[model samples]
Target: MRGCSRRAGRAARKRRQKCESSIQSVSLGHQLQYVRLRKFLHQRGFTSSLLQPALFTDTGRGLQTLKTIKPCQLIISLPESCLLTTATVLSSYLGQYIKSWKCRLSPLLALCVFLVCERHRGEASDWFPYIDALPTTYTCPAYFADGVLAVLPAGVRRRASEQRRAVRELHSSSRDFFGSLQPVLSQPVEEVFTYEALRWAWCSVNTRSVFMSHPSNNFLSGQDHYALAPFLDLLNHRPDVQVKASFNDATRCYEIRSVSGTVRYQQAFINYGSHDNQRLLLEYGFVAPGNPHSVVYVDADLLCDVLRGDRSLDQKRKFLKENNFVHNLTVSSDGPSWRLMTALRLLSMPQTLYRQWKAVLLGQAVCEEREEWSVHTAVTLCQRLLQDTNAALEKISDLLRQCDPAVREQLDVVQSLRQEERCILGRCLEALRGTVRQPDEALPCQPDDNDDDDAVS
Candidate 1:
């Protein structure tokens, strides 16, 4: 048995090497830009021999391992001088203007401005190789077309709208700041800092920047904490990978170490936090098909609508709001989230038992009858959500047929989001159904001598 196990392991290793060779063979066509980026990084003292840029079939472009990485191994250590931070912008030729300008600029805005300016410089800019490698456009909700945005779940759609508005407002408010940079530019400020240019730069920073804390700087408005880590940002997000990333004070480099090692030739990933599909789609422009953290949110207003006939609606709403349970009510595969179930329990209580509301909130066992009502309410809400999800999916399907390829891609992302929500709702509906008990099986609540709360009219 030991001999057979050893032979099996050797066979598996051989299979991995063969598969990796095929992956590398196909990736050669896509390495031109990355080759330039590598040379640029090496010139500036950035080194990572363990991983190389590769076009992955599953994750598009990401860092691939050349050898099997062991747990707790340092994956990449990027030198501080190579990072594009607000400090980098401050020290550049634009520094004097930024410092002398009467108006203060935000750290994020400064990064965006520096990115646009550097991008405009083309091959003339020292950072051109890095800039050239970035995606020309991003799929972040800010870039989603109106028709596509309309199909997103209501909660995500609202947040996307807010993001778009913020970007537009930022562009509008920076006209004076852009004008101030005319001294450093050969072209007019209007031409160099066009809205489209700024939008691209804004999305680049939003999607790719790493959080690195820097001490207070008077020239910048907010905290100087964001840094755009080149090459390192190529490590795509995986909801399951465990990694430790931070700026090493002694090494003077930003480093990421793998807690869960990756096998040879596979895409090496880093955790971008435990983000749900909605958040990942909104901010990163992609969806993890089976993200463990995915959930379907129950909108507060929708919950109220479902319990519209309840007499204690006003009181329950006030209580839920006061207790800070008014938001983040959700449904997962495991059934209703605690907050959602708790809210439903309070809403399920009859007016006669209004005084027992505190007990219910405190997690005291309510009468089985009340519990049944709460389960029934949850079933009805989940049914409504499922219906809405189905309807939205139908609309998306129709839109997919009529839209062009570009629009179809965006619609596809929204479709994935709705479909994931539908699955969660189905699971919740199933779980809620199983918990529901018939009225005849319900037991009476024990009486409390101090109160008559158990007596139902």
Candidate 2:
């Protein structure tokens, strides 16, 4: 009975996994169709005002209503500096539909509304309910790097500009060799990058380095013991910039050592963009902070300890919860504890996450060191586990053929977890396989009424 139950559960789990995969593919197809229709409208020069799709409630409405009673609206979420470009693009392409956007909202307010509307439009795929009331417009000023924009309160706008200049001065005075380079921000975050212009800015004076970049074109500049390079910049901190770099006088450097690994230095640059334009530019570098003397690497265990105890995870959970998503239970502390971090990464797979949790609690699994591990470690782990389990299943099949009833029963339990690729099951299977013998003094076995059990024997 026990063996039969285990096999039944395994079959059910396999079926569930298969069902989920099918659902995902269907969802993806629906998304693609929606995107196609949206792009078609966009290419046809439908401005935001007139291009807004018919409300989900209005889907059945006739074309006459869409042409006449269809109210036009617009919203923008990016920085005010970005608004001119956005407005120009939409207004120019929209032509006749341009005048319909006269909702009399501020440039800043309009931007935020536009972003919210656009984002929510695709939430339900085909369903689009009317937004009877507009959401409150967020008017806080912000600063933009290549594509990354940092929001700022009205109070910080003035200080932000001053800080940007101060950062530039620090970089200009630095004498370090590699500290002079600047790297571009990674993709997607590049929206903050604009050709050139400074607007409302807040400078984090406490920031360690400076960065410079432009969105339209890839240009990276860092100074003040700060260095930024494109792809290299992605690798935490390792500076590369020759002398004669005008940003700073001397190269800057910082001590980097942590329990987890190297403590990469992160610095921000603040500089004046266009004084008349009222824009402040900030750049981040990973090298040295205010002081650069000699390089030193030490055991950064203390840093790691601080990270594990950090309350940032709680803050992040709150952020996600407020934003409508369920609280993300997984996070990595910037500490020496690889165990939690590793488990969290693996738990990203919803199907096997519960087993991962059990393993973590049991101390059977830990955060595997990946500093030296190749970038493909996660993918490799999944593939290897799959291959190994399949082989184990085949071996178990042979054991059953050999008429090893005890072995077959143990394999039955193992097979359930193996089929689902449950990590904890793998650990459990290995432990059981290593055990020399089952507990002794077995009770007399009960005889089954069915002859099937004896038939197999």
Candidate 3:
């Protein structure tokens, strides 16, 4: 993990260079936007101990404390008036038209519509400063090029594809809704709300929105759903920092505070829940450096070695679903969850014993060969993990030699992810080396007998 100062310095240089490019004006305008935004907040009784949006390499734009802030101290307070929430939508002219359609537009989708309408409104849009401040480009894997996407771990690829489909669906739904209203409305479809424009709005909301609980509201329950916070959305994510963000009735503003003390000039980050890199890049367009929660999923095909044949594979998958054990096998900072262990055990066991094993799994009875089956499962799992870890190491070596900055940057992020995954796999292999050597037990898979520390790699 790079120190926060070092990471922040690197981010400053990248942003400075990016700012020197055509976005220079946008960065300059952002400074004034900060002034106006702070004034806007002040008028609404929103005040804090002087944290401002600053550049960082990992998070791009983020809030940095200008003064020492103790734990639980107020960071920033965004009034509900400043929040673009469900009520804001239901009350907007566009929101009213969508509501009259009698079709369900989720709060999130509705916010997407609101974002486009506001952006299209231009100077007529009351929130132009905030809208203009949003990045025209995103670094999220969802926006990764197809070639770049090809090299990502399977879980990230799957998520990026799903996000693409979801945004497409939302944009399609919204476009059709707006098109229906165009004849009765004054503006043309392309002028006000095109699919492309709506997609940009969807991206803004998707990447930056924060959770808001409007508990006492009548239109929507306080379900901890998301809402777009004007300036507050600029806060980036850091796994090491803890922040408490919620609506304070007494303050009547959405308040975010550092739960861990932050000193002058140190960037203050918020936890976007306990997320891994696959999730952060999928949603927020950036990855935290040295993210301990980085995880890699084992391809279910590994199970095919033991399960064998398409019929047996089908049965194994079906069995997992039926018993609610269907989870992608993962190796993370904490190593594999018990769900993966149970899955490996179930996959290696003979099909004939399933009838009895099902009962044993449900606490109905114990299998006589339970201990032996566990050893076999462990050996099989370790061997497979070793193979995967070695393959990833080879790929990591290949990524290191890429010359392009884009490819280089991608390499940096993927390298962090794969390295952590490799580490977990190595430790797992070590623990099972003894299990693999056990006598008189039928080995699930004969692993390479190499005992070198780097054998897994």
* Highest-scoring model, lDDT: 1
TM-score, cand. 3 vs. native: 0.76
Question: Whole-model Cα lDDT per candidate?
Answer: 0.81, 0.26, 0.63
Candidate 2: deviation at residue 60, Å?
Answer: 24
> Candidate 2, which segments miss by more than 4 Å at Cα?
1-17, 21-457
Where does candidate 3 stray beyond 4 Å? 1-30, 180-187, 215-224, 309-316, 359-416, 438-457
Residue-wise C-alpha lDDT for candidate 2, range 1-457, written one tens digit per residue = 0000111267865863454234211111124433554344344332222112221221111001112211121111111221122243234322222233333222222222223223234444221211111111111122222111112212223444455555344333321211111121122322332211111111211121123221331111222222211111111221211111122213221111121211111111112121111111112211121111111111123222322333343443343344333311111111112333333332222222233434433334332222212112222333444455567667656655764454443344334433433343244334333322334633212111111211100
How many steric overlaps does candidate 1 have?
0
lDDT of 3 by residue, 71-131 (tens): 8887888888888777777787765576567566666677777777777677577777677
Best-matching candidate per TM-score? 1
Give the poorly placed runs of model 1, Cα more than 4 Å off. 1-25, 28-30, 437-457
Give candidate 3's total backbone clashes: 1
| TM-score, one value per model | 0.89, 0.16, 0.76
Candidate 1 residue pairs that clash: none
Worst 10 residues of 2 by lDDT: 57-66
Model 1 Cα lDDT, one tens digit per residue, 39-146: 889898997778887776656778788899999999999999899998899999889888988988998899999999998888899999899989888888878889
Better of 1 and 2 by TM-score: 1
